[model samples]
Target: MTPMIEIDEVTKYFGTKLVLDRVSLTVNRHEVVCLIGASGSGKSTLLRCVNRLVAHDYGTIRLDGVPVDDPRFGKTGLQKRAGIVFQSYNLFPHMTVLENITLAPRRVHGVSRAEATARAQEVLARFGMDGFAQAYPEQLSGGQQQRVAIARALMTKPDVLLLDEITAALDPELVGEVLAIIRGLKDAGMTMMIVTHEMGFARDCADRVAFLSDGMILEEGPPDRIFGAPEQPRTRAFLDRIIASGRL
Candidate 1:
């Protein structure tokens, strides 16, 4: 099977500080990959580069059997082909949840308002936020807002989605709701790349886990190997500290 997303010897830098160093990986269609690492370990940066949000200084990214460097692969390709859910719920405060989703489909895809609204309604229903369509961002809890963000991304019907520490900002009670939404997506076979600290979720959801540190992937394998039987000393030590600190 062809990989849905591929990263080859990718490197990125900020001035003299190298953030990602010759990192590479492949995510197959209908597969979920969970990326875990310390803060500033380039997990999020790597995801951003895949969709051309960061624009890597070296290496290449391919999406859906097409090289990302092709000039034809511009914002339209990035927006429609690859969806991204941010750590923060970047919803528009003024727009209602319904409008938040319809805006993209209308403007980007040129779908009629009625058609977009119909699609938005279906996805929001699936996301369990159907009734909240008319509600403004401020009217919803952080979890609700995040779900709306996810729904909006899915509204475009992307082939692959990137999630960046999506539950880090929510209250513990709220976190479950957001995670449940993601779990639903995983079960529904959305190809996903997740940078997450939620180990249990990763263990349960990911087909594979990549352990990143110092701008490189230290190890990667099925969750059983990475989470239950880590090979690298660094990976084991990191997991130990995380567990000891009561974060996992």
Candidate 2:
């Protein structure tokens, strides 16, 4: 079967600095792959490349069987299929939750306002934000805003979701709520690629775990092996640091 996402020998650079170097990975349908590494490890950059939010300097990224950069995808098409949610909730401060969620479907996909709103309402209810449809971003807590952002991404019914340190901005007490939403998504078989610093969450939710260091994928395997018995010394060192910081 064709993989839902395929990154092959991809490389990226920011000016003279290389952010990703010959990285390769794949995520099959209904599978969740967690990317764990320290800051500046290129995990977020790699996720962005998959959706063309950031372009790779070399190699290919494919969605299903088609190259992400193919003209057929256009910018909107690719994004419609591969939705992304960031650490910071990017909702428009002026828009209500319902409006924020339905904006893309109504504007980019050309769905009628009524239909877009109906879909947004359904997604919001699923994410436990049904009562907040009229609430502005500032009116909700950090977790609520992030849930709205995830709901917005799902409004288009994306085939694959990319999450970049989604719980990073939340208060410690609020992190579980956001992570619970992800657990529900995993139970529902949503295909996902997540860049996160939450090692325990990664171990529990990921079908596979990848360890990236200095722009390279040094090790990847089932979460048990990657978290329990990583092969690379670099991978071991990283995990040790996480354990030292009491984060693993």
Best candidate according to TM-score: 2
Error of 1 at 221 (Å): 0.4
Deviation (Å) of 80 in candidate 1: 0.9
Judged by whole-model lDDT over C-alpha atoms, candidate 1 comes out at 0.91
* Candidate 1 residue lDDT tens string, 51-170: 888889998888987877677876677768889999898888889999888998899788999999999999999978899999999999889889998998898889999999999988
Q: lDDT per residue, candidate 2, 1-248, as tens digits?
A: 45999999999999999999999998999999999998999999999999999989999999988999999997599999999999999999999999898988988999999999899889999998999999999999999999999999998899999999999999999999999999999999899999999999999999999999999999899999998999999999999999999998
lDDT score for residue 19 of model 2: 97
Q: Flag regions of model 1 displaced more than 4 Å.
A: none
Model 1 lDDT at residue 197: 92
In candidate 1, how many clashes are counted? Answer: 0
